[model samples]
Target: MFLASSAKPIDESLQNLVVEIETQNPDLLVVAARQLRYSLQQTNIELTITEPRPFNVLEEFIIRAGIEFEPAPTPQELASLLGLDPVFVQSTIKNLQKLQTLAPKSPITVTEQGRLFYDKGAVPQPPYAVQIYAIADSLGETVNFQAEPLNEVVINLPSLTSILQLNESNNLISTFNLEQVQKNLQASGLGLHVPETGKIVTAFRSIGSTQTIWRKISLFLIFDSTTEKLTIHLRRGKQMLDSRSKWLDLLLSEGKISLDTLCKLPNESLNFEREAAKKYQNAETAARLEKIHQQALGNSQKKEVIQLRDREINQKFLEIINTAKQQIIIYATWLNHLNINPEFIAALEALAKRGVSIIISYGLEWEPENLLEIKEKLQAIKTPEDLPSVQLLGLEEDVYLQEIIIDREIYQCGFYHWRNSHESHIPLGELVYQVKKSQIIQEAYEILSTRCQNYAQKLWQQAVEKCDIQLARECLCIWGTLGKLETSLNQIQKNNWLELLPIYLNVVIHNLKSHNLADDSPILQSSLLLLSQVEAEAAFIEQLRLAYCQLLSAIAQQNPDTALNLLNNEVWAQFLRLHIAAETDSPTEFISQQTSQPKTKRKAAAPSTRNKKTKA
Candidate 1:
């Protein structure tokens, strides 16, 4: 792991803190760990960040574990903790916190899982590696065991005893994807489970390649439930001709062994013995990784192409765009904070200096919004020739490339935006790959870009064809269809149109009130004419004025105190007074006559009940 962002001497104060932590009390460690100056800065990792800042994790662990005990014991305080490197111990404990395996508290506690592993043993005791050895032929040669990737064991026994030993391992635990030794099994599929341990022991052999007929090897893997581990033994048949080799010779020479069986056998096989089986792995495993070993040929090598993620892609785009010597074509629906990033601007400026043409087609309705940026950039150029021509390609529809492509060569695609870099979190990326200079790739490039350009030209043509008359006619038809123009405040409020878009409705009302509803344009004429029609409808006008009087009466009858305050308004008093009746034969008097009539509404309730409820 690369440590520190740059090569520099460690700060002496931070170094002192590290020294103090080695033999310091909890209080001193907590104080040292919280120093922001040297906390994460203590160690800046460059790659494979297994744990977030080891320095920070160490400090956090100390604080969390030592908080209850103001001055906890040093690493030396615990028994059996002798002769250990203080720094490595701290680092190891910090790294061991996967799924609560270890908790860093005063008297650091090992969780149940950690205890189980320690109980069995560590390193060699837990069986990180296994070995095996066995015979192969009947040429009366000494048995030898050798496998390329797997270790060899020492077992020199006769065919009868060796076969019996192999049969004893009947555990058929499970299979790895396409990695099973072989499909061969006893007819009954019985005798596969070990009787004493009740564990599955799978035994299989690897048939050598046709080039080496006597290289077949045998192997077995046993799983123990309680320990939760895997121990495998691979044994190669001795190279010398012997009884085992003769048995294999009989199987292959007689044309009894299938070519597929021989061909599928790995040339470099692993031979493990029964002795090294630690049996940590249980019978059931939640996750089994499928092992696929492949050797690629031709141009499909991984090193030829690399994927960029997050900040890497952002930095790469800056690098790629600066290299444009001929032309730059950018298609995007949004512009991120590209202009604000000085590196991006500088690189773009350098590219422009090389007389490279930059064509950007932003596929959004508000296309002109970004045109200001181009104009601003051009203004910055001292010489007209040095200024890159920024042409905005008008697109008919949203036919835009997902990636911000440059010169149809290099491209960066992801959710990241040069625009949103100011935000706290950056949107992650999917992939960024350049096209190869092959016929298939170039053809694909031309087809996709041309399709986008063709659709863009069609859209621009439609926009240019839209004459003033056509636009005005469209506005007239649309307004006439909607007919949602307000005649008064009541209609506006009742429809809740104000909350939906109070600004537009308020503008229309304000224009009418100020006599600014001019008809110089078709849109204004359509709106003004709508209001004229509303005013001409006299029945609607009366209902509009009477609405206030009815509202006042309802409020007054329901809540007299609220109505009293509302009556204070001169206009409201006028409307309310108009509702009062004084014996007369006029139409207004007949309408007001109802004010003197008796009301006849009653609540349905039981007379005997003090408190009663009724259903609607």
Candidate 2:
């Protein structure tokens, strides 16, 4: 039989796509062409109408498209994103849907094969820490969060909200759900042990709350100068319970503490119920005050007729605002009356009544006073029980997008936040006039949301200049969480962030240079493979003169073995040549400088927690 199939002529993008057709009969062959474009209806990538289609070729195309391309773009949108034909995009998207490679969900969801391919393609997999860091960063970008404790996801990290709190999805951290150990975790004291400087601070907490009633703990992290070891300290304080709630039962069984801390007394004394009645009396008073307040907030105001396109956008935005269970993040630079409108404020006030924490982040301006005044008013619209939180950035960040996230259920992000009421400022390409910015380029995304949240957290971390025990220890604990990796070298490859290596190396170099040498500054040793790569592409090592000198000096003073390792590496030798005081290219001058200071060994701390090797 002759080879015949219904894909139209292949484009440049589909040309690179690896398609595999599993034919039922070995002898039969098929020829594929690119499909239709702008038909208003749909077509297939491989239209084999004669017999039972294997669907393998279709699945392969979808998997490749999904993993490699982004924003879950449709074949049409993907074509636009990649500068391909709309017909080719449409055909590819249809075939993928037929084969079930792409989920029917909006913005498209890739099948498991797509996920696995993306995971396995990393040249070297960054360990869990980097993955966590990267995830947190993505969430922050997706949801434009402002400053507040636990408000941002911190990049590449498991969703902090997903991990810390439960939602309708019940997608909490499966390994160690906080609910299982909530009492202990929420009441515990947070500590970060930094061996570099012996300084320590007793308390670390959110603003307004004076005492450090930690919601999370940072285990001690030690970076060994002699061995390049990263240890995650695990030892925890009291108030933590054993899983299964047995810790409390076990504690009561053991008869350890008094009735003061445990859930209940084993025996009910005559004094108890009478004491509870008085508590009820006080609650009754509070209920009466709540009733009075509720009367003040009469019937919901009449809905405004917004002139925006797509009525669905308005409905969805209000739905998210009205039904947020936990957290709401509004990152809008343009907060004027024309932009924000009255309906938006009413939604915000309604959610405030439900104890949904709302954070309003205005874009950073040259002068922040006007934004601060706006924030003051937003904060004023609060219920007696729950107050809306507003953050006026002292930041100089110039992000031009507005993002709104209601828990993880809904998210909206776009460049429309930059537009003012003036028609001149409207985006030139977007012809759809009535659509809300959130709906115009609909990318209903979760990963991007997580990334946005994570990015915000890192920004917060970077913003904190002082190294109190809490901040220092928390930052250091990442090394401890880094655990078995020993150095960023083994871990860097796993992340598949080779393209971003120059940026990362610059950061590591900055850290090394800034750290005080007397403070037992730790150097992250890298494999010769990575170092050579860095040396060839970016020349990162050559730029780190003081850092290289400090590292060589430390190795020379303490670990002769480490000094041998560096000297043996060909990539490091060329970098070392830049530091030769005189001629003749010898690292002995830097080594000599290192030897001048007597090396004092600071003892490394042991890993503190159980499951010492597992990812936190």
Candidate 3:
């Protein structure tokens, strides 16, 4: 809320842009700023640093000579023993005496301190003052800390929410370790010797900390809308930060600005009650919708090009999602980017709750951590029943196309990166094909479903055969939480599925117990949950359900006196325990390839005659 003061003049071009934007959009107020105001406490910290100072050759010899002699020798006696000048020996003795390492009297004796010095090769310097400057945002997130103050202008601003966060944030102070402190000092022209690779020999400690003081630093602010919160674009002197700069990345990460926050900010102004109405009233949005409506009325499969940024695509996606009845198919490059938008995620969650089938297929390789992140987000919104089948499958081969087909009706394929694309940077006219043709829609659906689902099923079988527990678990997760492997099975093949179910469960249990993981470990729980949700024959499904319950109970009760005794008596429980124990004990082998692998030689289902169509 801090504005530029009389100390600085605003640029004429920037002023014109602001005025023009404000005139056009009454809900938005553009402002040009060069300074940002934040509060801090100026703390005077007293630090004690221990440095390793190597002893000189003469000092080392003098101390060693004193320790070797039973009766401390006089300077003249020492000079005679060493075959050196008496005057030089006397001067060295005087220096040691001043340091309290040698007796001041005639006979040179190694004092208690001098003996310690001789025992240790290096001298340890006492506590020294080290000035450290650190800065944290209003949210108490630690950014960069340097020796010189990044913000030197001190000013008092209007009262605001100031979090008193020193004691609670003890770890913030710990960020300035001995090595880091030395670097900051050296950067500030303190002339501290900094090693290029190894640890700094100097040690540091703080004493008598001072209170923090507030300061105002110059930073560019470009606010186009009063209704939206600010998107921080950090400034370095006169130049703006590059998009790929590491420092900018650090600030973005520390600030916790999600994709949703960047694309669509929350309405900050209370000026308008009917925000939805105002959104529709915007000419740009109305034009886009009109074009889509016209396309729908025309030839069902005719292709058309549309220009939209990442944020616009999100808006269009929401429209399709909200209106979706049966299914939603999304084929993208990666999931982490799409998952960044909380609003889009929320919509998907709502659709899942409503029994809408959601199939997400990604082409690029997703890291284990990113996969876990996607799983957790989806898991949080999963109901106890896990309705509306949500499946995230990866296509291993190269997939350059980005497309979305909602209910086999609307199809939109584009060059845009979708969720990962930068709104400000992406040029206005990127090509995206929009079509409403029933034939094309069905084709896209088949391509996505047949490819992704088949890949997932294939991966599950391969992982099981290879005894790759990690990959097997991942495939099982896709099968259990999201979608069923929709391959047709005969009576014999169905039985094989049932037999493989226990082995899959056993493999998972073996993995958990191998790691000494707890009974309620996410891995164990998720594996069980996924198995329980698998769609199969009545008998097979029932067996999986009972096994899940028994394993959970048996594992939860470590003691034999409790439900462990009862659980042990259960037939399925005994089977599962023995199966897991056998697999765990062997370590290398699991269910043999003969029993676990199901033959996927089934015919594809015929395409439906009735075509439910929607326009792009």
Candidate 4:
């Protein structure tokens, strides 16, 4: 028996010591008379018994008597409160003082030796860390209680008799608290409700060189209302573990326990081992399929390469010509390399003779030295009699790259001049791929073919136009002056000369107005002579004046209305005075000077006309 304070009644002190002893070793018992005699000797003093037995019977007697004892009450109130009691309390204080004198004068602190003795004899050790379980019964009613190591105890006792007996008899039991049990279960990751059915179950594994190992365990707890009791099952494993009828009802209402304890119960099923083996086999099969796909892609890319040198290209040209069946599209910036090889021409002639269409597309700005050589080579090939066509198309100077797509299947080498010369060669190989008919590919081919034909035709027409312009410029230079052509224009017949006369007169007028020719020069005199020789009707003369006025309005460096008025007056006076002077030999020079003066003044005043004419 042990007591907390000397201030407590003698009987209560005796009962507290007895209760404390019986809690650990509950079978012990003590006589009532002997407990009374020991308590009466100590008024307000603590007493503890080192050896006591039959603790249960002593606990029962103490509970029936209703003795009261208080704890240390935060340790500070102990001495003052105990001193207020008369009689044996004073004697107990004196005894403590005498014991302290015999020991060291330092404060009375319990050493480790004293603490060990106190713990061994004074306190009841709990059997285990008590856990509370809240479970639902078959009727859906919930029950919660604490399990002490092995014993399960209800939360509340009905009377003191039961409390004293249980406290004295059990070393491993404690009262239950539901709130504490809920906190523990939440920490353990066993959620309160079961999850929905058919969710994808996840399992984790760590792969090694020779084998794999399962790393963590998880499962979706599935509940069925028809079963009337909850059962434990594995989602990644196999069969459900059957429930113990008593424990199943207890766990559902109570909540959780150690997983080890649940597994040790009598009725868990053994089929879950088989399910794990099946999952491992499936993982091994997936690894093998990825290896086969990589090998096929590697072989396809190794077949094609590029040929860079002209000599290698010429060598391959024979092979290309032999293989071509339909149309050949050769796109190159330089025609110099092809002109140097005679076999290339013979092969092309052979292909054309076989009735294949040959189209060679190359750049237009060929240097003169290169052009002479190219022309010479081309003249040597006789036109094949049986071939449907052979055409040479020139691309604009801005275009780059030299590619030849033969029969739309073989893509031959691109030229890199420094790396591969005619004397030293490198054969970068041809790329060949089969064309498959699909909507996207068909549309792309149609667009590219139309664009290529249109581009080629536009370049050919421009080249012809440029040649004609160059020839006309040379003829003008050979004739010594444009004025001589104007003099020859008068000899032509009137009806045959109408269009050419107006054009020649406007050219002379533009040159004189721009000061390119002096107003009294031979070109002006010849133009006037040509106009004079024409059989001039009044309506014809008026129409010519109006046409001249409109042309002046278009090119004049002044406002169009002002320029038109001046031009109309000047042209009409010039025409009328020319005929009048020819018939009457009298000149109307003042009228010409008056009309021409207004145009000169207007042109001088408006500087913006220069910018407007430049834009035009």
lDDT of each: 0.34, 0.36, 0.48, 0.34
Rank candidates, lDDT, best first. 3, 2, 4, 1
TM-scores of the models, in the order given: 0.24, 0.23, 0.31, 0.23
Best by lDDT: 3
Model 3 misses residue 141 by how many Å?
A: 64
| Per-residue lDDT over 1-616 for candidate 1, one digit per residue giving the tens place of the 0 to 100 score | 1112122122333444434432332111111111110000011111110111123434344333332333544544422334556776565565554424355563556554343333333201111222221222222222222232222334332232233223322212222111222111112233232222222222333233111112233322222222212222223421322344344445545666432233222222211211122121111111110000011123356432345666676666677777765555665554432333456556656654554545454445553355677546643632122212343443433322334445556544333344244534353554444433344334434533553444433342343355332322222211211222332333323333222122233233223222233212233223222222232224343333333333323333444444344333343333323322121233233223323321322111112332333321
Can you write out model 3's per-residue Cα lDDT over 1-616, one digit (the tens) per residue? 2222221233432454445444554434333233334445333333444443667887777777777766767788889988999999889778777656677886767776566555666443443556555444332444334556554555664211222122432334445666665555555453443333211334554445534445443333333222233334433333544432333335545864332223222333222322432442344333544555455556454444344454576566678778876567777766653534567778877776565656677777854365777766664664223222456666754445667787677887654553224533232444455566676567666666666655666676576567664555455544432234222122113434444555345433332332223444444433433333344434454445444443443453342232222223243333233332221222112112112222321121223334434221
lDDT for 141 (candidate 2) = 15
Candidate 1 has its poorest 10 consecutive residues by lDDT at 34-43
- Candidate 4 lDDT over 1-616, as tens digits, reads 2112232222342455434433542222221101100000001111111221122332222211111222212112333543443344334323322322112222233333223323333211211222223232211123222221122333221222121122212211122243443443344444331112111111111122111111111122222211112333321122322233333435535664322233322222212322322333233222322222232244356433332343455556667667876556664566653434556667766665554555565655654455766655554443232112345545453233444555556554333332235654343442222222233223333433443544543442343346443332222211112223443343223224343344344444433343334443444333443444545444355434443432343334333333334324444445554332222222233234334553442111111222232210
Encode model 2's per-residue lDDT on 360-437: one tens digit a residue: 544455433465665566657743212223322222334444556565445554334224344322232211112122
Report the error of model 3 at residue 438, Å.
0.6
Most accurate candidate by TM-score: 3
Task: Please state every model's RMSD to the true fold in angstroms.
Answer: 36.0, 33.2, 23.3, 48.0
Off by over 4 Å in 4: 1-314, 337-340, 364-368, 379-382, 385-389, 413-415, 418-451, 459-616
* Positional deviation of residue 576's Cα in model 1 after best superposition, in angstroms: 93
